[model samples]
Target: MISILFLIAVAASIITAIMGLSFLISCIWEKETRAALYAGLQFLLMLGLVFLLFYLEATAFFETATGRAGLILGLVLTGGTFALLTLRIGSNPQALQGTRGLMVGNVKRYDERDIVFARNRTLSPGLEQYQAYYELHPEHEQYDAARRKRGGPLGKPGSIDKPQDRPNVAATLASLSIPLHLSTPEKFNPSQHPEFSQQRVELSPASASARIKGYTLSIGAKLVGITEINPLWIYANRGEIFNENWDDWGREIELTHKYAVVFATEMGFELVGTAPHSSTTIASMANYASGAFIATQLAAFIANLGYSATANHLRHYDAALVPLAVDAGLGETGRLGYLMTKDFGPRVRLGAVTTDLALIPDNPVDIGVEDFCKICKKCAHCCPSNSIPLDDQEAVNGTRRWKLNAETCFDYWGKVGTDCNICMRVCPWSHANTSPHKLIRTLITRNRYSRYLFNSMDDIFYGRKPKPKPAPEWARFDE
Candidate 1:
């Protein structure tokens, strides 16, 4: 019995020490200096404890009947505690309750003009468009006025502005602007070439979906999915900039596409980890440009194949990309109000192409994100603007989900001179998709118990509020 107790103690110590060392290495590889330092300290402490335990055992401390009984009792108590925690927090008879009936039926279609991005874009105070919008929704006039008075456009001087990062931010914005021209009606019109009309290619839905997915992957898309266009996903009206030839600028948008191809591009982890700083905006714009480029190429490819297709990207989007992405089996809508994919979480920018071409639609997946998000509110707790909700999902736009305070979120952006990404930066799911994190994600997707265990472990190791990482060397122009 004494020998058995000694073996158990030694084995436990060895396992804990190995885990600590592994975590320390991961933090170092990911450039998480603070976390690495903490991990290193933890590994040392674990080693010290193991040495102490072995010394106590070598001294024959457990040879006495009382000591042996105490050792066995301690092991049983520890094991029982862990078992109780697993059963209480990890066991869920209804795994899909959080996401199953959410937005399932009778979802209220959202208006594009109601989005904060559209509201900010149309803030040309005193202009006819501006006045018309304010007159239609008088409640937003005061909020819009405040946002304009702040005068902190992207890359400009404001609360979180870094002069050294302005050039990179400006370059990112410029690159994204070029794709705006390609999103207009003029580009949507099919080619009038003599042979173009007769060059129609026919392929099965499965074959076409596979080809499109492969091509998108080749062109730098991180993820891709196909889905039939749901009318509810389309905007009720146009709110962003539009060409003069399209007379119905603010009118209800009529997108006659049969299918939608949604894809996402990765935002660099290092850049995004900078949160409200210029590096975050630089990453955001960079991914937007990449998504636009991919969507435009795919649209052009379809057009050349004698089919009508319109690219929906950063500058011009007719549909809510998140819902389209969810329906296309890309990911689940997370608590942070972003599409959380199995691979990248919310660290991706979405783009889409709407076309008349037929394609097999991918079914929406239930990977336990909605369930995990219910318990893991790290993003909400870390949000600088406090725009994310802390309570349960409520009914909004006919769907039961966490609704973000868009006004406050954008207000913070106006003050910061960049889109505040503190929530994204601190998200547990937003960790680098390496082997260790991938293993955690695999467990998280499987059952409720793993989600609770990983969430607790994540908070302990990475902290409930992680500090922002420094920008990459190239982006640090101050040096």
Candidate 2:
């Protein structure tokens, strides 16, 4: 019995030490210095404990009556505890179910003017568009005025706006704006060239979809999905400034596209891990530019094929991206109110090309994200603005889900001079998709018990409120 017990202890220690070493190595390879340091310390502590256990066993401590009794009691207690945990958190038999009904059934269409981005862009104090908007929706006047007083994102002297970082951030924004210049009817309308419009190429739905997906991937899209355009996803009116000379400033936007090709561009983890910093803003703008470049090229490609296509990217979006992305099977809408992909979680920027091309639509997937999100409140706990909800899903806009406080979130962005990404930084799913993390993710996707276990383990390993990592060395500049 003593020999058996000694072997069991040795085996358990070896397994734990191996896991610790693996995690330490992974952290080092990922350049997570803080995490690596912690992992190293943990590994050393585990080794020390294992050595102490071996010493106790080798010294014949368990041969004495009291020592033998104590050893038996310890083994029994440990085994019983593990058994209880296993029974209490056993894997569920059912696969991931559709939670779409929670947010889609009886949903009310959202207005573009009500969106924070639209409001911020249109609410300059002495502008005609501003006055018109205020006259139409008087309730928003006070809040809009207050935000204006605080100054706006990036351009203002705020918490994260270092003088040295401003140029890089501005350059990224400038690059993003260039694509918006091309997002006009003059650019989208193939009819402007009668010869090009006259030559039509016919292809099957499957072939066209494959071509579009392949082209998008070739042009740097991390993920792509096609879906039939749902009218409900389109905005009721044009609230953004699309064209300066266009007569229809706030007129209704009529998107007659039959298909929508949505795609995502990954935001670098190193930059995004910096959270509410200048580096994060730079990454955000860079990804937005990538999305814009991909969407515009794809739209032009379809137009050249004699099919009408319009790129919906940064500074020009006719539809809500999250819903379209969800419908297109790119990802599910996470509790953080961002599209969570299997590879990158919410660490992605979305772009779409709405076109008249016939294509096969991808079905929405059930990858246990909904269930995992239900148990994981790490994002909410780590939010600097405390804008994320801590409770269960609630009904908002006739749909049941975790509704974010967009007002507070945007306000925090203005104060910080960057989009505060604490939620994104700390999401367990946002971890690098290396072997260890991937294995855990697979287990998480397989069962509800795994979700709880992983969530708890993640909290223990990487704190519930993990601090933002420092910006990369290359990102630093002389102030």
Q: Which candidate is the best by lDDT?
A: 1
lDDT digits (tens) for residues 10-118 of candidate 2: 6776776777888888888777776788788878887886897788887888788876787778778867755553442433222122234455467655677778888
User: Considering every candidate listed, which one attains the maximal TM-score?
Assistant: 1
Among residues 3 or more apart in sequence or in different chains, the pairs in candidate 2 whose N, CA or C atoms overlap within 3 Å are none
lDDT of each: 0.79, 0.78
Point out the worst 10-residue segment of candidate 2 by lDDT.
Answer: 90-99
Worst 10-residue lDDT window, candidate 1? 91-100
Q: Name the regions of candidate 1 deviating beyond 4 angstroms.
A: 1-20, 41-100, 186-197, 242-246, 477-479
Please provide TM-scores, in order, for all candidate models, with all chains considered together: 0.85, 0.84
Which residue runs of candidate 2 sit more than 4 Å off their true CA positions?
1-20, 41-100, 103-105, 188-197, 477-479
Error of 2 at 344 (Å): 0.7
